[model samples]
Target chain A: MILQLIDIGYLVAVVLFILGIKLMSHPESARKGNSIALAGMILAIVVSFFTPGLNNIALILTAIALGTVGGLYSAKTVQMTAMPQLVSFFNGMGGAAAALIGLVEYGDLPVDDIGKGSVLMASLVIGSVSFSGSLVAMGKLQGVIKDIRVNKILAFLVLGLAIALAVYVLLSGQPKPLLVYGLVALALIYGLLFVYPIGGADMPVVISLLNSLTGVTAATTGLLYDNKVMLMGGILVGSAGLLLTLLMAKAMNRSVSNILFTSFGTAAGPAGSGQDGD
Target chain B: MDAIINYISVNQQEFYIFILAVFVGIEVISKVPTVLHTPLMSGSNALSGVVIVGSIIVLGKTDPANYLALTLGFLAVLLATLNVVGGFAVTNRMLEMFKKKPGKK
Candidate 1:
C-alpha cells in the first residue's frame, strides 16, 4: 500500500536524526548534522498529511503553518547570546504541545474510564510545571526576572499547596478543565517564584529539569493515545534529561537545591565568573 | 486538477523550502569562527535532552507496534546523550586550554 511509503520516510527520518546527532558531536560536522535532523523532521511532517484517516487537514495545516512561521522567525531573529532563552522557549513549546494533547484526551474520556487518574494527573502536573517553569527559566536567562533568594520554607509551603491541590483534583471525581487550567496557572506563578530565586549560572540545570518535565508530559500523552511511540520517546527524553541535569549539577559543584535557591548565573554580580555566589 | 495540485504540493513547494532552510542555516554557521562552533555544539547538544525524553517514552510503551520505533528511538537517545556528554567534555577541555601557560622562548 502507498501508505507504507510513509513508514519508509519515517525510517529515513530516524536515520537522519541519529546521523545528525553523530555529526553534531564535532564542530566541523555540527551544521550538517543539524540540517540533517531538520530535514528529517520536515520529511516526517510532510508524510503525516498522507496518513490514512487524517481528516482535519485544515486544522493540521494551520497548526503546521503557525508553528513553522513562529519557529523560523524565532530561529532567524534570536541572537546567539540569547540561545538559552530560545532553548527554554523551545522546550516550553514541546511541553505545551504535550499538555494540550493530554488535556484533549482528558476531555474525551468516557465516564466509566477514570481508571488511570494518577498517570493522567502526573502528566498534567509535569506538563504544567514544564510550561511555566520554562517560561520562568527564560525570564531568568533574559534578566526579566531578577535573580534573588527566596525563603526556603516559603518555597516548600507553596509546593505543599500545589500537592494538596493536585490531590483534591485527583480525588474529586469531577472533570474540571478550569481546575486543570488553574493548576497550570498556579504552577506558572510558582515557577516564577522558583526560578527567580535561582541564579543565572544554574540555567542549564533548570533547563534540563524542564526538559525532563516535558518528557513526562509526552509519556502521559502517549498513554492517553495508546501510542507506544510517544511513550518510548518520552521516557528516553526524560531519562536523558535527568542524566544531563545531574551531570550539569555535578559540573557546577552544587546541589540541585543550591542551584535553585541561590543566584547561580545572574548577570548582576561578577557574571560568568562561576567562582562566587556558590 | 486536484491530482495535479496534490502532485505539485508534494513534488515542488515543500521540498524546496526544506532545502532552502537547511542550506541557509548551514551558511550562517559557516561564516562564524570555528571556535564558537564547539561551544555552540555543546549548548545545542545539551538541548537534545528533549530528544532523549522523547525517545525513552517510546521505548517504555508496551505496544508491539512500536518495536522498531523503540529500537530506533533508543539508538537516537544513545547518540544524542553521547553528543551531549562529549560536547561538554570538549568545551571544558577548550576552556582549560585557555588556562595553560604559553611555552617559553
Candidate 2:
C-alpha cells in the first residue's frame, strides 16, 4: 500500500538525517552532510504529499514558493558576522510552524483525553516561547533591540508564571479557548523576558536552547498524530540541539544555567571574564 | 493520571528511540572544533526547518472553512520554508570561505 511506502520513505529519511548529522561534525565532511540532510528533507516533504487525507495543494505550493524565495534571498546575502542572528530567525520560524500545527490540530482532539491535551499544551508553550525568544535574540544580535538590564528577580518571576500557566492549561482538561490564548500570550512574554537579560555574547548557547525547544515542540506534535517520521525528526533535532548547546557552553567554560540566568556583556562587567582567560 | 500513564506506556518505544538519538547526537558532534561551531549551528537551524512537514500536513487536513488554521498553516509553511532555504544558503556561504582556491598552496 501507499502508506507502507511512505513509512519506508520516512525511515530512509531518518537514517539520512542521522548520517548527515554524523558527517557534519567534521569540517571536511560538513558540506556533504548538509547536502545529505537537504535531500532527506526533500524526500520527506515529497512523501508527505502522498499521505492519506492531504489536500489543498494550491495553497501549500504558494506558501512554499514564497518561503523559498525569501529564504534564498536572505541566506545568500547574510554576512558571516550576522550568521547567528540568521540562525535565530530560522529557528524562530521552525518554532512558529510547530506551534501553528498544534493550534490547527487542537479542535480535532477528543474532549476527554486529558493526556493528549496536555501534550498539545506543552508543544504550544515550548513552541511559542522558542518563536518569540528567538525573535528577541535576533533583534539583540542585530542591535535593533537594546540589551536593557532587567532585574534577575523579574526574569525568574516571569519564568515561574509561564510554567504555572502551562500547568494550569494542562490540568484544565477541556480546551477552554481563553486559557489556550492566555497560555500562548504568557509564553511569548516569558520568552522575551527570558532572553532580554542574557547578553548578546551568549547567543550561540541561547540559539541552541531554542532550537531544542523547537525540536521538543515538533516531537510532541508527532506524538499527538502518531506520526513516526515527525517524531523521529523531532527527536533527532532535539538531541542535536541539546548537544550543541552543551558543547557551546563547555567551549565557553560556562554552565547552561549560568548562561540562562546571568547577564553578560553589560556595562557592569566585561565579556569573557568568566572564562578566566581560557 | 491513569490516562497519562497509559499514554506514556503506549509511546514507550518512542522514548527509547529518543534516548538513543540523544546519545548518538551528542557523540556525533563531540569532536567538532570551536571554529566550526557557528556553521554547525546554522546547519542545524536549517535541519530544524523539518517542521515544514508538520505544517503541510495540518494545512492539508483542515477544511477551507477553517480560515484560522489555513492562515496560520500558511504562515507556518512560509516561515519554515524560509528557515530551510535561508539557513542552508547562509551555511553554504559561510563554508565557501574556508575552501582554498584552486591555485592556492
Candidate 3:
C-alpha cells in the first residue's frame, strides 16, 4: 500500500513538472508554472520521508533548513545583472550534489555490477565536470578570472583520458575505486580547460549546455535507484531543456566558431549582446 | 555487444522511460519564444533541483558512523536544497521583471 502511494505521488509530481515546463514557455503563465513546479518539488520532498532506511533525520532536516535560509537570502538580495552568475553558482551546487551522491554510494556497490557501475561512473564524471565547470564559468562571468588561452588538442586528450578511465573501471571485472578517483579528478580538469577559454558573452550558451549535462547526471541517479520522481524530473530537464536551447541556437544559425569566438555576441541575442561589459 | 544488449534487455523499462522522456521534453519545450529563454533556462535549473530527491535517498541510506559518506550526503542534501530554493526564487524574480508593465505593450 505504501509503495503504491509513493508511486502515485511521484507520478503526480512528474505531471506537475511537465506542466511547469510547458507553462514556462510563455511569459503570461510562466509564474504559475514555476509555482506548480515548486509545489512538485515540495511534494517530492514530503514523499521522500516515506522512503525506508532514512537515517540521521536530524542532520538531514538541519541541512535542508540551513540551505533554504541561505538560498532565500541570496535569491532575494542578488542584483539582476548578476543573474547569470547566481544561476551558474546554484547549478554548480546541483552538480556537486550529484557527484557527492556517486561518491557516497560508490563504496557500497557490489564489486562487479556492471550496469550500476556504468551509471555511477557517468553521474560521477559528468557531475564533477559540471561542478568545476560551472565554477569557472561563474568566475569568468564575474571577471574574477582572466581568459587564458586553451589548446583544443590538450582538451580533447584529457577528455579521452577520462573516458578511457571510466571504461576501464566499468569493464575491468575488478572494481578499481582508485581509478574511479582518477576519473573524477580528470573530468574536473577537463571541465576547467573546456570552459576556461570561452568568452563571457558565450557563457549563456555554455551554461545552458552545462545545465543540461547536470540534468543528465541527475537522471543517472534516478536510473541508479529506480526512482520515478528523480528520473522523470531529471530527464525532462536534460532532454527538453537541451533540445529547445539547441534548436534556438540553430534557428539563429549559431555555429561552433560562434561558441568559441566572441563575434556571436553582436548578433546572437540579448544574452550575448548585453552581458559582456568588456 | 551482447553485454550491452543484455543490460538493455534486463532494464527495458528504464530505456523506454528514457526515450519517452526525451520525446516529452522535446515536445513540451519546442515552442518557447526567444524572449522567454532566460526564464525558461533559469526555471529549468529549478526543475533540475529535483535531484534533491536523489540526495535525500543517499543521505537517508548512508550510515551515520561513516563520517565520509554521511558528511558528503549531508552536503548533497544541503546543496540540492539550495539549488531548488534559489533556482525557483531567482526565476520568479526574473519573471516578475518580465511581467507586463502597466503602460507598455
Candidate 4:
C-alpha cells in the first residue's frame, strides 16, 4: 500500500515537471513555471524519505544540511554576469552525484543480466564525463583555465580508451574493482580534455550539452532502480537541454559538428554570416 | 520474433511514456529565444538534480556497515542537495531581474 502511494506521489511530481516545462517556454509564465518546478522537487525529495526500509536517516539529513548551506552561499554570492559559471558549477555537482550513484549501484548489483550491466556502465561513463567536462567549462567561464587548447587527437584517443575500458569491463563476467574504477578515471580525463580547448563564446553550447549528458545519467540511474519519477525528470531535462544547445548553435551559425570539430568561436563570424565549410 | 514481441509487451508502458515525454520536452522547449536561455538553463540545471532521488534511495537502502557505499552515498546526497539548491536559487535570481526591469524603467 505504501509503495503504491509513493509511486502515485512520483506521478504527481512528474506531472508538475511537465507542466512546469510547458509554462516556462513563454515569457509571461516563466516565473510561475519555475516555482512549480521547485515545488515538484520538494515533493519528490520529501517522498523519498518515506520509504519503509530507508536507513541512515541521520547521515542523509546531515549531508543535505551541509549541502544546503554551501549551495545558498554560492548562489547568493554569484555575480549576474557569472550566471553561466554558476549554472555549470551546480550542474557539475549533479553529474558528480549521478556518477557516484552509478559507482555504488554497480558494486551492489548482480551482474548476470546484459541490460543491467550496459545501463550501469553507461551511467558511470556518462556521469563522470559530464562532471569533469562541466567543471572544465566552469573553470573556463571563471577565467581560471586560460588559453589552453588541447590537441584534438589526444582528446579523441582518451575517448577511445574510455570506450575500450567500458567494453572490456562489460564483457568480463565479474566486475573487477580495478577496471571499474579505472573506467571512471579514464572517462573523467576524457571529459576534462573534451571541454578544455573550446573557446568562451562556445561555452554556452558545451554547458548545454553537458547538462543533457547529466540528465541522461540521472535517467539511467532511475531505470536501474525502476523509479518512474527519476526517469521522467531525467528525460525531460535531457531533451530540454539538448534543444537549447541546438538552438544556440543555430543562432551562432554553427552546426554541432562545427562546434565540436573546429575552433569555431575564435573565427566567430559576424551576425548574419553564412555557414562556413564543415 | 517471439522474444522481441515479449520484450515489447513487458516494457510497452515504459516505452510509450518515454516517447510521450520526449515529445512534451521538444514542444515545451521549441520557441525559447536567447533572452530566456539563462533562466531556462538554470532551471533545467535544477531539474537535473532529480538524481537526488536515486542518491537517497541508494543511501537509504545500503547496509550502514558498508563503508564504501555509505561514503559514496553520503557524498552523493551532499552534492545533489547542493545542485538542487544552487540551481533553483540561481534561476530565481535570474528571473527576479525580469520583474525589476519594468519597475526600474
Candidate 5:
C-alpha cells in the first residue's frame, strides 16, 4: 500500500513537471510554472523518504541542508551579467552528481549483465563529459580561461581515444574497475577539449546541450534502479534541454552543429551580437 | 543481443512513457519567444536539479563501508543542491528584470 502511495506521488510529480514546462513557454505564466515545478520537486523528495531500503536519515538530511544553503546563497548573490556562467556551473553540478552515482553503482553489479553495464557506462561517460565540459563553458564565459582555440586534429584524436576506450570496455564483457575509471577519465578530457573551441557566442546552445547530456545521464541512472520518478524527471529534463538548445540556436539563426564546431565569436561578427542585452 | 532485447521488452512501458514525454517536452516549449530564451535557459537549468532525487537515492542505499560512494554521494548532494537553489534564485532575479521591460505588452 505504501508502495502504491509512492507511485501515486511519482505520477503527480510527473504531471506537474509537464504542466510546469507547458506553462513556462510564455512570459505571462513562466513564474507560476517555476513554482509548480518547485512544488513537484519537493513532493518527489518527500515521497522518496517513504521508499523501502532508504537509510542514513541524518546524513541525507545534512546533505540536503548543506546543498540548500549553498544553492540559495549563490542564487541570491550572483549578478545578472554572470547568469550564463552560473547556469553552466549549476548544470555541471548536476552532471557531476549523475556521474558519481554511476561510478558508485558500478562495483555492485554482477558480471555478464551487459544491459546494465551498458547503461552504467553510458551514464558514466555522458555525466563525466557534461561535468567537465560545462566547467569549461563556465570558464570561457567568466573569461578566466582565454585563447580557447580549437585544434581540430587534436580534438579528433581525443574523440578517437574516447570511442576506442568505450569499445574496449564493451568488448571486455566484464566490469573492470580500472578500465571503467580510465573510460571516465578519457571522457572528461574529451569534454574539456570539446567545449574549449566553442566560442562564447554559442554558450546558450552549449549550455542546453550540456543540460540534456546531464538529463540523459540521470535518466540512465534511473533506468538502472527502475525508479519511476527519477526516470520521468530525467526524461523530461532531457527533452526540455534538447528543445531549448534547438530554440536558442534558431534564435541566433545558426545550426546546432555549426554553433558547436565553429568559433563564430573569434572569426566574424561583433562581440556579443549573438547574446541578448539584458 | 538477446539480453538487450529482453531488457527492452521488460521495460516497454517505461519506454512508452519516455516517448510520450519527448512529445510533450517538444510541444510545450515551442512557443517561447526569443527574448525570453535566457530566462528559459536559466529556469530549465533549475529544473535539472531533479537529479538530486537520484543522488539522494544513491546515498541512502550506499553501504557505509564504501567510503568512495559515501564521499561521492555527499558531493553530488552538495553540487545538485547548489544547482537547484542557485538556478532558481537566479532565474527569479532575471525574470523580475524581465517583467519591467516594455516588451511585456
Candidate 6:
C-alpha cells in the first residue's frame, strides 16, 4: 500500500505540470505556471523515495541541491537577452541527465535485450549531442565563440563520422560499453563543432531543438527502465519540443536546416527591411 | 528518529526551496516592461513544446481507457503551438507598427 503514494504523487505531479504549462500561456499567469511545475517536481522527488529500490536519499538530495543551485544561479545571473540560451542550457541538462540514466541502466543490465539496447544507445547518442550542441549554441548567443559559418566539408565530415560510428556499433557483436561511451563523447564534440559556427539570432530555434532532444532522451530512459510512465512523460516532452521548434521556424519564415546552417540575423540589415505594408 | 529527521529535512528543505524559486520566477516576470510582453509570451509559449511529445506517447500507447488523456494531450500541444506562433506574429506586427511614420502614409 505504501507504493501507492508514488502513484498518487505522480498523478498530482502530472496534473501540476499540465496546469503549470497552461497557466504559462499568458504573461500574467506565468508565475503560477512556474509554481505548478516546482510543485510537481517536488512531488515527484519525494514520491521517488517511497518507491522500492530507490533508497538513495542522500544521492538524490545532493543531485537536487546541485541542480537547484545551478537553476537559481542561472535565473538570477542570466541577462534577459540570454534567457533563450539559458533555456537551451536547461534543456541540455535534462537530456544529459536522461541519457546518463539510460546508460547506467544499460550497464547494469548486461543481458542483451536488443530492443531496449538499441533504443538506449540511440537515446544516449542523441542526448549527448543535444547537450553539447546546446552549449555551443549558448556560447554563440553569448558571443563566447567567434561568429562563423558551417563549411560544407566540416558538415560532411561530422555526418560521415557519426554514421560510420553507428554502423560500426551495429555490426560489432561484442558488448562494447566502452565504444558506446566513446560515441557519446564524440557526439558531444561533434555537436559543439556543428553548432558553434551558427549565428546568434538562431538561439531560439536551437533552444527548441534541444528541448525536443531532452524529451527523446527521457523517453529512451523510460524505455531502458521499462517504466511506462516515464515513456509517456518523455514522449510528451519530446513531441512538444519538436512541434515548438517547427513553429518557431515558421514564425521566422525559415526552415529548420536554414536556422542551423544559414547565418540569419547575425548582422542586422536595415531594421525594417522585411516589413510589408499593413 | 533518524528516519523522522530525514523526512522532516526533506519536506522542510524542499518546501522552502520550492517557495523561494516560485517567488524568484514571479519577481522576474513582474519586473519586465510592457514592451517585452510579446517576446516574453512567445518565448515561454515555446516551453509548452513538451506537450507534443507527451501527447504522442499517450496516443501511441494503444490503450482505450486513455483515449481522453490522449486527446487532451494533443489539444494542449496544438493550443500551445498556436500560442507561440501567433505570439511571434503579433510581436512582429507590433514592431513594424512602431517603425512606421504617421505623416509618411
Give per-residue CA lDDT, model 4, range B39-74, as digits (tens).
Answer: 888888899999999999999988988999999999
TM-score of candidate 2 versus the correct structure, residues matched by position: 0.93
- Tell me the spans in candidate 4 whose CA falls farther than 4 Å from its real position: A264-278, B1-10, B103-105
- The whole-model C-alpha lDDT of candidate 1 against the native structure comes to 0.53
Worst 10 residues of 5 chain B by lDDT: B96-105
Superior by lDDT: candidate 2 or candidate 5: 2
**DockQ of every candidate structure:** 0.03, 0.68, 0.75, 0.64, 0.71, 0.03
Q: Calculate the i-RMS of every candidate, to one decimal place.
A: 15.3, 1.7, 1.3, 2.0, 1.3, 15.8
Clashes of each: 30, 0, 0, 0, 0, 9
RMSD of each: 14.3, 2.4, 4.1, 3.1, 3.1, 14.9
**Which of candidates 1 and 2 is the stronger one according to DockQ?**
2
- lDDT-best of 3 and 5: 3
Worst 10 residues of 1 chain B by lDDT: B53-62
lDDT by residue for model 3 (B40-94), tens: 8888988888888989989999887999888989999999999999999999998
List pairs with backbone clashes in candidate 4: none
> Chain A: TM-score in each candidate?
0.79, 0.92, 0.90, 0.93, 0.91, 0.84
Ranking by lDDT: 4, 3, 2, 5, 1, 6
Q: Write the per-residue lDDT of candidate 3 for residues A10-123, one digit (tens) a residue.
A: 999999999999999876788999999999989999898788778888898998999999999899999999998989888989998999999888888885777888888899
Report iRMS (Å) of candidate 1: 15.3
Which regions of candidate 2 deviate over 4 angstroms? A265-273, A276-278, B101-105
Ranking by DockQ: 3, 5, 2, 4, 1, 6
Worst 10 residues of 4 chain A by lDDT: A265-274
lDDT of each: 0.53, 0.81, 0.85, 0.85, 0.81, 0.52
Model 1 ranges off by over 4 Å: A1-19, A50-52, A111-115, A261-278, B1-105
lDDT of 1 at A105: 44
- Which tens-of-lDDT digit does each residue in A1-278 have in candidate 5? 99999889988987887787777778888878878877887888888888789976788889889988888887778787888898899999988888888887888777577787778888888888999999989998888876477777787787678677766676677778887788889889888988987876677789889988887787888888887777777877888889889888877777787777666445555665434433
Top-scoring candidate (DockQ): 3
